[model samples]
Target: MSEADFIARLRGIATDPAARGLADDVAVWEGLVLTHDMIVEGIHFLPDEAPQDVAWKLVAVNLSDLAAKGAAPLGVLVGYSLGDAAWDKAFADGLDTALRRFGLLLLGGDTVRVPAGAPRSFGLTAIGRAPEGGAPARSGARPGDQIWVTGTIGNAGVGLAMRLGEIEPNETCLAAYRRPQPQLTFGQAVVPHVHAMMDVSDGLLIDAQRMAEASGCRFGLMLEAVPLSAALLAVRPDVVDTRLAAATAGDDYQLLFAADPAKAPMIREIADGLDVPVTVVGHAGVGEGVVLTHKAQRVPLPERLGFMH
Candidate 1:
């Protein structure tokens, strides 16, 4: 199918105000909104992976970006690389499933075929409306703000290991990589109070460092306090270094946020109400480097904390 035809098909699926036909030029609402993400085969996923999972992931990854910004999903535009007709249908079915699962709709999309023997790639451009007034940005974190992460880190990393056969696939670990739940509800619940917020896609340490750099602050993480899933513990009980690597590894789509000290109680209350685990990993300080304090001594951190170019 051609890109225009794919888009026309999507236009028929859902109708939303933001997605209504535009005459080539249109003015959008102001504030922090709109997010786009692309995933390529071999880089983001294996070429032999299931088409349904790939389709779900394409949308989920983009939605994760919006969730990090505390934005509610408005709609999506899919950009696909054409393949077999049956495969394309499966992909569309998966995309529809994700859209309904997240209360998002497919506005439009484009599709194109890659040359034979070329690398495969797909992209999803997600549009979202910032909550009420504005969306959270990485530059908003302040000194003394406590850093917290929703759910356990490193599950996706561990799941990747399982995919590579470096580790055995367990129910917990495989679930992390295959179906990551974007913290949309959590982001909305905390948007009003968070000083700064971001989703931990590129590992906690690296993403946290990025947040620090953007906010002109430093982050201090207590290595002992970082949370790990039971599957991770079972695989490598004494592998502190592996845990640290997972903490810095990419693909875990959980939210890492900072908030004022005064709002700690409220944050806990919200987490409890939502039944999501929130861990206070560290604190933001008035400096420019990420410090990992372990056993009262500063540890030499990894040179590349997360995904690197």
Candidate 2:
């Protein structure tokens, strides 16, 4: 089937009340909203990547955004570029697995084909509802708040490196890169106590800068305090600076949040209950820029802390 034909078939199956027939306007809502992203072969994923992994990643990335806002996944609309029948079946199988695992339903979407020799692309639009009270915003953090991260950092980036054969793909490293488990439960647990929150798609340094900019506060990150997975250390034993670099590399789907220091014990308890480690990496200040301190000495911040357009 051609891309347009696929889309027409998908349109016939779509049932999202918020989509309004996919007329192409930005979706707006009071307690919920819609967001979409597109990933292209040779751009988002390597041409030879597995169909299952690609499908999983497409859904997981969108869920990461919803989790950052403390929202629940409602459903998703998918747009796939037409491929051969065998490839399409594999993609669908992968999508189904991810959707079932994440409690997300495939509402409906279009599929089409690009011109020959053009890069193949896939798009997904996710609809999510905010928490009962309200979703956490990137703008709500305040000075005097403690910044915390859920789980270890750098796993996904390390995994990607291994996948590219930059390093050996030991079990640890491979787990980090592929099949990143989004901190959905942890995000929900921290929502009530957190003043601001976001998933660590980009490196912590960059994402922290974003929170600071959005909330009009300064962030002080303690370099020694950033958490690293056992996998990262296993791969690069003597690299003292690996953690710092990981803080700027994209693709870790953990949550970075700010909460009152007084709530630390409770937050830790919550993390323990969820079996996810929570680490206090820094504090938010009244200043304007993000600062990194190593043993009380200020370190030079990276020019680009994370992903940049």
Cα lDDT listed for each candidate: 0.80, 0.81
Q: How accurate is candidate 2 locally (lDDT)?
A: 0.81
TM-score of each: 0.88, 0.88
Q: Model 1: residues >4 Å from true position, as ranges? A: 1-32
Model 2, 87-161: lDDT tens per residue? 779989999999999998789999887787777799999988877766667767899999999888888778888
Candidate 2 error regions (>4 Å): 1-28, 238-240
RMSD of each: 7.9, 7.1
Clashing pairs in 1: 3-111
Cα TM-score of candidate 2: 0.88
lDDT of 2 at 5: 75
